[model samples]
Target: MKLSSADIARYVASDISDGSYVNLGIGMPMLVSDYIPEEREFILHTENGMLGMGPAAAEGEEDWDIVNAGKQAVSILQGGSYFHHADSFAMIRGGHIDISILGAYEVAANGDIANWLIPGPRPPAVGGAMDLVAGAKQVWVMLSSHVSKNGEPKVVESCALPLTGVGCVNRIYSDLAIIDITADGPLVTAMMEGLKREDLQAKTGAILNFVPKCEILKSFKNEA
Candidate 1:
């Protein structure tokens, strides 16, 4: 299946359990909140010191003080609260967060992550990603199937960039497929509609083992 970045985000949101204490990383990770069911209770924690975060606000409702790891203006749900940055990290480092969804540049077969920095000149800053990767109970990665604009594979034998966390990722939700890192290898748990296992393998750099289909649960319905 040809899935877009938004499809990856929706996939991540669908897996998040109700009442999960989640921390979203920068970039595409921020979009997961948009797909969450409003009636379900989930508390979003920002590493910069806010909790109970609502989705991105409407045009006139943004509060500068309430933002996420991306520093974009956000809103607070009814039971939302704020705290100090140190306390926020404390929660993360203490493993209080149930899941942390992050964007990645590359992920290895062993679940090693390399998302914090680009490999060339003018590299982006490595924010709280390192801590989140190491601390969260489960690390969910949202990214594309390939690396570089040239369509190099992002799922690789080993990451070329500086590492974010070794064996830190639990599940990967990508544009083309959903992968779970197991002792055997990177298992293709699910693929987008119409995409074949061979087609996905051609695009991926890592050795992929296609697990037989089971009763897979639908996570999100396309609204648009």
Candidate 2:
């Protein structure tokens, strides 16, 4: 079964460290904030200048002053601090962030990520993605295993879209499996239940390596 947005977030949350600082990118990646284990005490950072932020605000509990880089309503933890964009970028660029979770369009076998734009004449939006990818200690992506409309592969041998950052992605959290990009190519670290090695390979644009110690993502299904 395909993992829901919440399921993916929960899985990503599990991999992150308890006291680590993370920058959650917009779109699907932002929802990860909602699933972080309460005891983990991970600090959430937003490019808009909020550190120690909380999940999306409850209905009627929204706060205009508190928001993420996406401009969505957010909440602040007790010790959360709001600062200027300059300082925020410093935190992002100076390598203070431990892990960054982002949504992606395509990821190359060499760990190249293309998430900012597709080839077309449209208004471009390249926010702090480039900085996060380049500056973070580890970069993790959250996306569907295949293109939503055509069922084409998103984890490709090479990215066809505009590059966000090359050789930056460490791991990918997709609906069908958890893949790790290595010097050898895309490694199958974990896959969803009932999906054989061949099944994941057929849908992939590049090769999929099976590490004997690879994990089967059966526990994530238990979250349902």
Candidate 3:
């Protein structure tokens, strides 16, 4: 079965180390904050002038003024502080963040990302993606295993869309697999249950190697 957005989010939360500062990009990346353990000490950052962000606000609990970079309602943890947008971006561009989880359109085998645009007449917003990729200690992409519309691969030998950053991605969390873009090439590090190497290969435009013992990923992130 395909992983739900929440399930994919739980998987992303597993890669986050305790006490790390993380920026959750818009879309599914934002859901990860909800799955992270309260004891884990993760400080969620948003490009929109909020730091130490909490989970999405409960219905009727939303402070319309309090939101993430995507303008989605959110809560703030104890000791969480608000700052100027310039200062917030300073924290990002200054490289103070530990990891940035972003949703991707296409990621190349060499760790290049193409997420901001698809090279058409669609009105585009660049947002903070480029800065996040450049300054974060590690950039992890979160997306589906394949492009759903055409059944084309999202993980490709080369990105077909415009580039976000050159060789910036470290890891990818997809619906079917977890991959690491190591120096040698893109490595399929983990996959969902009942999925085979052949199935993953058939969907990917990039090459895949079965590590003989590729670890299957699970989500106990919500557990204490």
The clash count for each model shown is 2, 0, 0
Candidate 2 regions exceeding 4 Å error are 219-224
Tens digit of per-residue lDDT, candidate 3, span 1-224: 56667778888887788999999888778788777866688899988887789877899888899988888788898989999978988888898999999999899999999999976788987989999999899999989545556798999999889999999999988888888999888888788778878988888889876566887765444557
The list of candidate 3 runs beyond 4 A from truth reads 218-224
lDDT of 1 at 87: 93
Look at candidate 1 and give me any clashing residue pairs.
1-195, 147-152
Cα lDDT tens digits, model 2, 1-224, are: 77777788888998888989999888888777777787888899998998898878999998888888889898888888989999998988899999999988899999999999886788898989999999998999998455546888899999999899999999998888888889999998888878888988988898988889777765455543
Query: Candidate 3: what lDDT?
Result: 0.85
Ranking by TM-score: 2, 3, 1
Per-residue CA lDDT of model 1 for 89-118, tens digit only, reads 899999999999988889999999998786
Q: Which of the predicted structures, 1 or 3, would earn the higher TM-score when compared with the native? A: 3
TM-score of each: 0.89, 0.93, 0.91
